[model samples]
Target: MSDTPRATRPGKTPKHGTGGRGAAPERDHLRADCANCFALCCAALPFAASADFPVTKPAGTACGNLREDFRCGIHTRLRADGWRGCTVFDCFGAGQQVSQVTFGGVDWRAAPESRQRMFDVFPVMRTLHELLWYLTEALAQPAARSVHPAVRRTLARTEELTRADAATLEAADPGALRAATGELLLQVSELVRAAQVPGRRKNHRGADLMGAKLAGTDLRGANLRGAYLIAADLQRADLRFADLIGADLRDADLRGADLTGALFLTQAQVNAAKGDKTTRIPAGLTRPAHW
Candidate 1:
């Protein structure tokens, strides 16, 4: 038997509603159940053969690796196989929305006719869910508290769109969803970037800049604690006054970066950086003795 690690999810709680401020702190929002979905994105989206994704699949064709049970056949060996991209990617709660609400919990095996319906819902639901992930993360920022009220409202609005019925989800104008999400993401970016403006950048607390390209940038007074920065490109960047507590920095490029005043960066993160001895670290972060 393959010693593959499968996610054993027992009592996993998905967000039933967006937690407004004053609500109880939410438990973790786990990876969505793809089996519950119609496997819509997998069937509806197209992938080109590239370094990031080695295989090219056309729209409407399920990934060859996807089993009839709506699971990835190569789940355990994603990297060993050509599916490393899928393994690293997270759909937040999109897979669940597309599976349950959009399709009313119908699967291809149950109703072959629903296959086309699943395709119709995939693109729309994916876009909304992606925005939800960003907006949800943005709401967690303390330094951005001034904008928290607006951020929370926007998150709930976007979350509502994902839960719309099929005819509503399908007939809904894609332009509207794109425009709203684009505006919100742009606002969040502007708020973060404003602090990086020439000698005038404001601070961001616990913001989400995961997988963002911030090469050779200045990020002084930024509060980035508990952010998901996996594989983010921060080469030669300045990150002074940044809080990095509990942030995931795996495979993130921090070479030639200056992290003076950044808080809560662990020794493990320092070791993960492709930095030279000359690289500057914040007082909060100490170089591993091994380094």
Candidate 2:
């Protein structure tokens, strides 16, 4: 009924859409490729003139490592060259989603005037894509089956946010977005923990549970904003730093756990508690400053 033509003189499990077997999904059209993108992430994001790189760059300026073809010239040795940030950043299909889905593959180079629009929307698109990644991950939880409907609804909402106008997207505050994602993630956490470790009650907010055994936990800065927590055990956690705007205390257990500079956790979140002193605060927040 889809106007799809019949193949093989009958029905032998009709071929995949016009593209071929698993073509559209396999294509992952939502993913970006430098071969097609303008390297917007590199061009739109700014980095300090730190030891990570030889120079500092402003937003919209191309990194020194970027070539005319929009590929990183030092792709193979970014870490050695202090561009390690580039190596770890994943746009989560934002680049391709914006390029193909939003703009229909209209390259900035091909349409110079489109550059302004592209730059303006790049940041918002990245945020939406990042949230999309987390939402997709949240939906994968078997224990969170109880809230699958909510997850689906939120996922749809976030997806719509991605397609919003620049004004609307920009108007979306980080705090609000964090709250939305946090609500879903918290549900996911409780579901998984309840299903796996029944009768286990872990006090998260304002409680110093450092060096605690928190294996297979998912605590990506679930608020805890301004809570007191020093040296809590957090291992095998899937932390994406989405809700780390203003967490508290420090010296928490983070061995084998992936903190990776979770969002908004200040030096206070580290210095006040009991971490290895090596507890990773977000790159934007550091010790001594909070001290």
Candidate 3:
């Protein structure tokens, strides 16, 4: 709803444990660990008064629902209370990284003077972590094995950047890093899609298909990067091996849709869409509870 790329649902503990600082970044480290975090996402990200959020909140201001222990006071009823966006946001473990490693485990409340800076650095770190998530996924694609070395090098460099101090992180350029990594991911997508869906794949990159009646469409191996598919009726669509990087899937119906092996499909995208138990999602992503 907020259009932010999420990793996992908030207020829920991830199944994996986090590694210590200075260790190599792994998939586990890319997940949100609310226990080690200071509720930064609740304080840093601004929310508009929309269907996703009932109240208007500015950046750097703590949410009214955040409790003393940095947990959501209404965690059990966020959606019922019109805080659906919070459930969809994950911060991709950026909250803990900024709270523990970047700020040396010092919370903004304990060091009030550092609050603004911490809030400023949170989004920057989130971008780096999100890129790391995509790069990690790209590295795991067997069809993209040819670019694994490049992906590894880029991932290593990105991980090193995440270890920088708060000031360095706030001043870092995630856009440039994203561009470089995006090219490699494009190559990976091409390799994977080509191998998975042989001939005459759909080319709908960046198309405006909002609310289009696309139910049961054979869109396997389609190039849908940056496409606007909001509120589209995609029930039973064959999306296997499709490139969904940066696609807006908000409210798109995915009931019974086959998304197996979909490239660059983030949990945030899936969570934002409409789905059911029959939807076949890619491995490593959980079905939205609302589904």
Query: What are the TM-scores, per candidate, against the unseen true structure?
Result: 0.63, 0.60, 0.91
Model 1's C-alpha root-mean-square deviation from the true structure amounts to 8.3
| Model 1 per-residue lDDT tens digits across residues 183-275 | 564555455445543455545445577788988877765656566777889888888645564467766778778886454354456644456
Q: Rate the local accuracy (lDDT) of all candidates.
A: 0.60, 0.54, 0.84
Task: Supply candidate 3's per-residue lDDT for 51.
Answer: 91
For model 2, where is the 10-residue window of minimal lDDT?
A: 1-10
Candidate that would win on TM-score: 3
Worst 10 residues of 1 by lDDT: 1-10
Comparing 1 with 2 on TM-score, the higher-scoring candidate is 1
| Candidate 3, RMSD to the unseen true structure | 4.7
lDDT of 3: 0.84
Residues 1-291, candidate 3: write the lDDT tens digits: 222222322233323222354232358778777777788888888999999899999998888987777777877778888888887876788887888788877788889999999999999999998998898888778888888788878887888888888889888887887788888899999999999999999999999999999999999999999999999999999999999999999999999999999998988899889999999999978898899
* Candidate 2 lDDT over residue span 1-291, tens digit each: 000111111111111111343111121323334444557777777888664456789887777766666667777666576664554444545665566545666666677877777777777787666565555555555667778677767776877777666567557775677677777767765665555445634345554444556555876535444444445555455544433433533444544555663543333344343334544544433333212
